[model samples]
Target: MSAAAIESPVPESVLKVEKQNKGTVDALYKGLSDGGDMGKVAKLIASDLEWWFHGPPRCQHMMRMLTGESSHTKFRFEPRCIEVVGDCVIAEGWEGAQVYWVHVWTLKDNVITQFREYFNTWLTVKDISPHGCEIRHENHNHTLWRSHPGDLFKRSLPGLILGI
Candidate 1:
């Protein structure tokens, strides 16, 4: 048999753990969608949760809703795809396919310890059993703030120059 065929797949226990982690994240999302409570989510996350964000701070409008800073938050966050690989649960969220956000959750003991947010970027997670991991890319399109901070600045350049 070829080496590819002889290679062993991921263990069943590991797969179960991954599925459980994904389910936890899904419930968190559902809670947020149903306006349940943020305190509950806090419990699911680690006390020292690490959050990483790309693009300008102003474009992080979702933070307002997450932090209870804005009661008029209209945007809804729902995962289009979720993948559990290794010890991480990666969720790709989108609103009507125009805006996208990828949330990477690194969990320890079923509590989220680290979180990474990649706004306006396509995300992919791969499992390389008996090895490491690799990431792939894809094309994405969105509005100014939803696309990139630089794009927002560029769109406002003409107004800035004309002082209008």
Candidate 2:
């Protein structure tokens, strides 16, 4: 199924949270791209930011952007898909065929507190909630977003071959 088709019905309250989170993420990206008010970007991100990276060590593009080591003109991050799952926002984008990225931003009180970056790697985000005594089960898990099949194959092939 397509990424957009994975969403299940959600309450209005949840939708409101998603909308607010979307706006925060959008503003962050816009500010980064425009090279505009970093104070605004700083406001969106928490001081004690938790960051994780997957794929090559050299592919820390987002960290570089955040640190002012690289400009958007050099490496722009324009997410083609953005979705909210629980308290997290997932943004996916690609640059040509060789570079695919997924950013997972976890927010608390509308400020991004955690970031996980995946470069040239396929990602699937699932929401798992408790059901009575069970902490996780197939029925309790809901897929929120998935990398496109075409993109997944292209990005995952090398890793699969190398058993990475």
Candidate 3:
């Protein structure tokens, strides 16, 4: 997000709301990157904000940042692309040909109401309606597709790993 996320002479069209929401998200990130008070950004987030993380619980660092519990003095987010799709802002982060993260943020009335984070893998947005939220994922396997015996050599191959 950047200050350029918003236009000064706002357009009076269907996209007006989206621009405002983008502006809000941009400001939030700006504040974080500038080491400014996050309390101001909190206003841009809904009181009942819904947050979900796909992957392991190793995402505690991000949770700390969001909750103002981190000791780091500065934060930086270099997004390769940020776009508004419907009511969500999708940010794809990459370095060279390798993508490291995908952030999906759902905003309503210029406030962030929901967020989903996918790290080190392709993002998958699953629609889980309230009525169908009871599905247990305890048996889910993160490496099933890539961990077959036939792929052992592939897994053993040397490779440079990078994480965001």
Candidate 4:
């Protein structure tokens, strides 16, 4: 009924990974759900924080947005898992979320510093900017999710290996 009354956003896929990943998913869930000290979490971030981006939704930007320290944004993330591989965490969540998108986070030194995101491309453009430009491209089409396509686990593996 109310925000506080609502359940946490952690997903089942993540729970499965928590057992093998040294509580990776669980620790992350605690950090995200409780809004704990992310500075300590920075140790998990991979050095080669990567993403498919030219601007905005980059990992640093996303962290700032998530940590509620960014001046540019006014929304907070309520994360839920789509999957996990090694150290890479892939999730579909809300950003104050009016829509769902898959975010893949790479952990290095115990902190998250790099990431890639996939969502309804239409929503991506809409949320980032109403007027699309050369730099801005529509990514999430919903067809993939609707059609049962793509290997999120395989996709996340490269980054996870790189991170570890």
Candidate 5:
């Protein structure tokens, strides 16, 4: 069976959340790219926001971009794909083969409270349930999304092998 056919349908509520999350993420990127509307960007994120990074020290591109330490021209974060899994909005992108990035934004009341950035690494989002664990069966972990390279490398063999 086809993958789409095998997968269950997404609930309407989830779709609505995904759309709203996508819009928020898009607006943040647009504000950064325009180099104006810093107020709008500020409104989207929380005052005491927490951020985490898992990559090279020099690859703190998102933090630098949001903090005005780096200009849009220096490193633009145009997300190739944006997905909402539960309360997190995941955005993944890449700049050629060298740089791959994934940004996980957690929002509450439409304001981003936490940001997790992954650079030059593959990411897989899964939903684990402790309640599903039984005597013999392992805890259920349903995969929500996976990071993928841009169209340029998608069709290549190495990209397929690496699944990035």
Candidate 6:
């Protein structure tokens, strides 16, 4: 027998990758759920990481809109903990108000390297190097403020009167 034992590399990583992938999914989901902090996310994601979703024009557009001198907020499907491989994670889940997004992620040196995402709300990022992260909501609905519809005006009148 040789000094090195024979081993199939892919299977070796399966369990670990799945766990990492689950953690990744959970981290993003917690951020997207709103009412949470984005900084926690920055801490979780490795600097050289990129996330992508290919649905909801808002997925990308909103990200830009919300990004600021302080970019905060994140959104993604509530993924199903499906499979894992060393440095790779696989999951299926919903994105947007009602859509599906499937993804796989690879990590090296505790930093994310490649991300394979499928669906309409897709984004590709590289050299992530997150200094920090923030969390907020993805409001994908008709603007309530634009029309100033009767209901909204009614809702505002009370606040206006109260100077609130």
Q: All candidates' lDDT scores? A: 0.59, 0.73, 0.56, 0.43, 0.72, 0.42
Write one digit per residue (lDDT tens) for candidate 3, span 32-97: 666655788778788888987765566444456878777435334556567665567766554443
On TM-score, the candidate that comes out on top is: 2
Clashing pairs in 1: none
Which numbered prediction scores highest in lDDT against the true structure? 2
Q: By lDDT, highest first, what's the ranking?
A: 2, 5, 1, 3, 4, 6
lDDT for model 2 comes to 0.73
Residue 30 lDDT (model 3)? 70
- For candidate 6, write residues 1-164 as lDDT tens digits: 66334333444355555566667656655664554455655565566556654454544532342232334334534554444433455455543344444455666544445565554322222222232211111233311111112222223211110000
Candidate 5 clashing pairs? none
Looking at model 2, which ten-residue stretch has the lowest summed lDDT?
Answer: 155-164
In model 2, which residue pairs have backbone atoms overlapping below 3 Å? none
TM-score, one value per model? 0.67, 0.78, 0.61, 0.42, 0.75, 0.44
C-alpha RMSD for every candidate: 9.8, 6.6, 12.9, 16.0, 6.7, 17.6
Cα lDDT over the full model 3: 0.56
Candidate 5 all-Cα RMSD:
6.7
Candidate 2 local lDDT, residue 6 = 58
Model 1: per-residue lDDT, tens digit, 1-164? 88844546667777777778998888778767777478776678777777777645755655666677754246676776776655777776555434556677788778888877766664433332333332111222211111222223323211110000
* Ranking 2 against 6 by TM-score, winner: 2
Task: Put down candidate 5 lDDT per residue, 75-122, tens digits, no spaces.
Answer: 888888887766778888877767788889988777899998887766
Tens-digit lDDT track of model 2 for 1-164: 89644555556776787789989999999988876557778899999999988889888978987877876567788988887766778788886767888888988789999998887877766544443321122333355567653454634432211010
- What is the Cα-based lDDT of residue 61 in candidate 3? 41
